[model samples]
Target: MKIAFVGKGGSGKTTLSSLFIRHLAAHEAPVVAVDADINQHLGAALGLDEAEAAALPAMGAQLPLIKEYLRGSNPRITSADTMIKTTPPGEGSQLLRIREDNPVYEACARTVRLDGGDIRLMATGPFTENDLGVACYHSKVGAVELCLNHLVDGPDEYVVVDMTAGSDSFASGMFTRFDMTFLVAEPTRKGVSVYRQYKEYARDFGVTLKVVGNKVLGQDDVDFLREEVGDDLLVTVGQSPWVRAMEKGRPARFDELEAENHLSLQTLRNAAEESYGNRDWERYTRQMVHFHLKNAESWGNAKTGADLAAQVDPAFVLGERSAVPQPS
Candidate 1:
């Protein structure tokens, strides 16, 4: 399952993402934890030392290699310019398996050794001064999206991503790349407001969003979330002293998390297990094509738009609901 955690900046999304990855790894499940946030703190939350996390390679910096290798030696892809997000893998395109022996994994992923089992960690590099006006954060988002598009994970395998905060995720189509999205919302007006915004934006694309109420202090906090989010609220995590200690640089064990937190985590795990299934590749491909064509019309050229449209699988396009109706 490909899962993403998104919420208000300080709403504990990254913490929940890290804890969930740890939980899966503890069960000896194969998992890849991706830190796609510009802030890049998931590594530390997953128990990596600051220096070790900093030493890991940035997946964003490796975008060229990803594109080159995934495209492989396919002669059909004559020019790199045409290989946009909508470009589907051809016959010679490389497929990524998360296991160590897979060439794609060996070349691009880093193994983070945890207590129960090892999990993979990939990060999008932090925004730098050079990128101030030249590039948008979507450049990094595009890399993660393309990599996942090429990856083929088994049923039990998992990909957990800590995405950028709040409604900013709507800036790019990357939000649609996940199988499920967990919005870790605090019980506050701003938090509920973001949830409304996210739901309204994602509803049009058929995205699944489940809200996890975080940092709940008492009944009032839970009540607020219930009132605002209702059925979308899956679980609630109370404020944890153990989590607080960890935040202060103490070595708090995952097993030592508050009981409520553990239950909330278990509930989340069960939800993911129930939701796991094959991805709708046709739907995803159509969505990608739609996004690319929209971009082409607004900022790209006619030839590029035609090239993107040609990459769509004909059968998928025939049944695609991604095209917006034209106004008469």
Candidate 2:
């Protein structure tokens, strides 16, 4: 499943993004964590040094790079439309490239070894890279389409996006592209206030967002936020002075604590469960009349499939099983 995390800055969006990536890695899943926040810092928060995070451009940065490649060094190409190239990555590479416009962007993909497992991260370089005039340009629809196509076509892969904070065009636009969105909110008053707005903004994009209450000191604080929001509170990450200390450049350890033992991580796992639908695929697929009819024989659910297709889209469904005449 492809999931995106968004919230106000300093609201723990990246922290949760990194932690989720770590959690998925431990499960032996092939996961790609895209740091879409143009300003960066996800790598460092996940335990990478400055030089490491500097090498990647969250997906946003890759867009301009694609434009540059299509334009090339030659001044003759006035428009990028005809000049773009889609260079497919070679076999055995971690990136399953959709297509490449220029080879420059692929340089952003680097494999890093982490404690839980290895992660391939791409960052959106800070807005400082582009001149003010160029930075004002809007994102291309083609680029967004290409990225979504890649995600949809991939096999058994998961994408976790760390988007910029707030209702800005960047965050709103990116948030809409995800199969699911997880909003990270802290225990403070400002955090809860922003989270309410975040939920509204997510709904504007027609997404059902799940909330993660971070840095909670106790159950009362979590319950209070839930009461105020009046939504199903997914999971709360208990106040982890250790995790906070690490983010601040202080050396704090997570030695004895079980990563899964934390409430925050538990909610994230639950969110993953719901969004991935790995556990409920049977019920979900059964409900999908067309999909169920196609796979029922192979899956040994043909009886249910026949009944479902009869109730839903019957003509083609019966024809598919060679048991009835197809429609004209």
Candidate 3:
């Protein structure tokens, strides 16, 4: 399953993402955690300090190599530079297997030690001074977008991503890529407003989204969330001293976590697992093709001087498991 954690800034999406990854890992499940946020703090939320987290390879910095490797022997693609982020995988392209060793993971991911178990972590990296006024954060996120587009996961394997806050995820077709999205919302009006934005934007697509209420102290807080998001609310997490300790760099085990909070995490895991389906894979391919053509028409054709729309092999549904047939 491919899952995304998103919400308003400071809504603790990173914390929930880290906890969920650790939960899945502790159970001996195969899971990968990708930090797609421009802020680059999911590593810290997991366990890494300032220096350690910064040392992991940033996917954004290694875009060319990834494109080159995934481009594989596909005859449709002439060069890595011409393969935009929205490029869909087709016959002869190198597809990714979840939790399996691959060149992209080798170049960009790292193993993080959590008390419960362990997780494979990757980040899009932080926006740097060099990128100041020159690149949008989406350019960095493009690496992750392309990675997800080519990735194929089974029922047991999981990929959990910490997405950029709020409606910003709607900026790219990446928003439509997840099997499920957990939008963390606080009780405040500002937090619920983001929920409205996500609900409105994702409703048109087949995006499966649920609201996870964060930092609730009482029934009133829960009521506020229910009223704002209605049936979209999946579960609520109360403030936890255990989480506070984790935030301070003190380690924790799931056994020691607050009982209710632990249960809430399990609920989230169940929701994600239940969301797995064979039906959505076709739509995933179309979204990639749609964005590719949109980008091609807007700028990609001028930039690459080739018809980028030809990159789409209509019969190839990216996340679907089947034999690929070459374009005729």
Task: Write the residue-wise lDDT of candidate 2 on 1-328 in tens digits.
Answer: 6677877788888887877777667666667666666457778877778777676644544665554443333233333332211211111111223222225336555666655567666665566645466743224222432243223223345677787676553321334445567877776777777667766665644455777787778878888778867674677777566666767866343333345435456566666656665323223222233332343334323422332222222221111122121121
User: Global lDDT of each model?
Assistant: 0.76, 0.53, 0.87
Tens-place lDDT per residue, model 3, 165-281, is 878998889988888999999999998999889888888888888999998999999998999889999999988988889888886676798888778889998888888854477
TM-score of each: 0.89, 0.66, 0.96
In model 3, residue pairs whose N, Cα or C atoms come closer than 3 Å (at least 3 residues apart or on different chains), thus clashing, are none
How many collisions per candidate? 0, 7, 0
- In model 2, the clashing pairs are 57-123, 57-124, 58-123, 58-124, 85-101, 86-100, 87-100
Q: Model 1: what TM-score?
A: 0.89
Say what the RMSD of model 2 is: 13.2
- Could you say which candidate leads in lDDT? 3
lDDT measured at residue 262 in model 2 versus the true structure, 0 to 100? 50
Give per-model CA RMSD: 6.3, 13.2, 2.4
- After superposition, which runs of candidate 3 have C-alpha atoms over 4 Å from their true positions? 320-328
How many angstroms is residue 280 displaced in model 3 relative to the true structure, after the best TM-score fit?
Answer: 2.1
Candidate rank order under TM-score: 3, 1, 2
